[model samples]
Target: MMARPPLPLWLQDNLTLRLQDGLLSLPTSSNNSDDKNSSLTTTYNLISKRHVISSLVIPLLRHMRLKKEMSMRSKQNA
Candidate 1:
């Protein structure tokens, strides 16, 4: 497989901003039972680094990989 290209500066900046926003938006823990449940879910969604990585970054990497593979195949066929 060809070496993967580096992510564009703009994309890196966007992802950084998203991660920072997610971190900042993390819900604080609460004592009330109902609030606890909601906060747990919110924390899982907002604070888990894996959420952003899996949801946004992985798909982008997959798309980039597929594009590179297609280009390599085209070059080989030429």
Candidate 2:
């Protein structure tokens, strides 16, 4: 059995950030309910700190994670 190589510092940091983003994204419901009242309530809910952080952080984290994975894989292959 072999241990995997450590990720480069930047990649390690990125993965950490992505993990944090995943944690921050748990408060929102993405379901498309036909109930107008629920929809309106959700819109208001987006004003909360959790919702704001999740919206701003998740996509950027996902993109960064993908980029880091690509680089990490390339390094491994080389």
Candidate 3:
């Protein structure tokens, strides 16, 4: 099987920059009238960020794992 080429340096840097920007843009705590409301908002933001990160990362991991398994199977068959 042919090996895949690495991503171009500029594209890799762009992806890294975008990921950092995404993380930096996640919601942070803010001042509010009610303590309970503020707490809820903070909690919601945290959960939302977790959900977003997992949603993006989990699929990518699954795809990588699947690719690895397929590669192994191909090698075994060969």
- Quantify all predictions' global Cα lDDT against the true fold: 0.72, 0.64, 0.69
> TM-score, each model?
0.45, 0.35, 0.54
Worst 10 residues of 1 by lDDT: 22-31
Tens digits of lDDT, candidate 1, 1-78:
899988777677767887677642555666667554776676576656566667678878988899999999999999
lDDT of 1: 0.72
* Lowest lDDT block of 10, candidate 2: 21-30
Sort by lDDT, top down from the best: 1, 3, 2
Backbone clash count, each prediction separately: 0, 0, 0
Best of the two (1, 3) by lDDT: 1
Residues 1-78, model 3: lDDT tens digits = 999999656556755765776642556666666667777767777876676567555666787799999999999999
Highest lDDT model number:
1
Question: In candidate 1, which residue ranges exceed 4 Å CA deviation?
Answer: 1-6, 24-47
Candidate 2 lDDT over residue span 2-77, tens digit each: 9998856765675566567553243456566765677756655555545546654576688789999999999999
Q: Which residues of candidate 2, in runs, are more than 4 Å off?
A: 1-46
Candidate 1 residue-pair clash tally: 0
**Which of 2 and 3 is the better model by lDDT?**
3
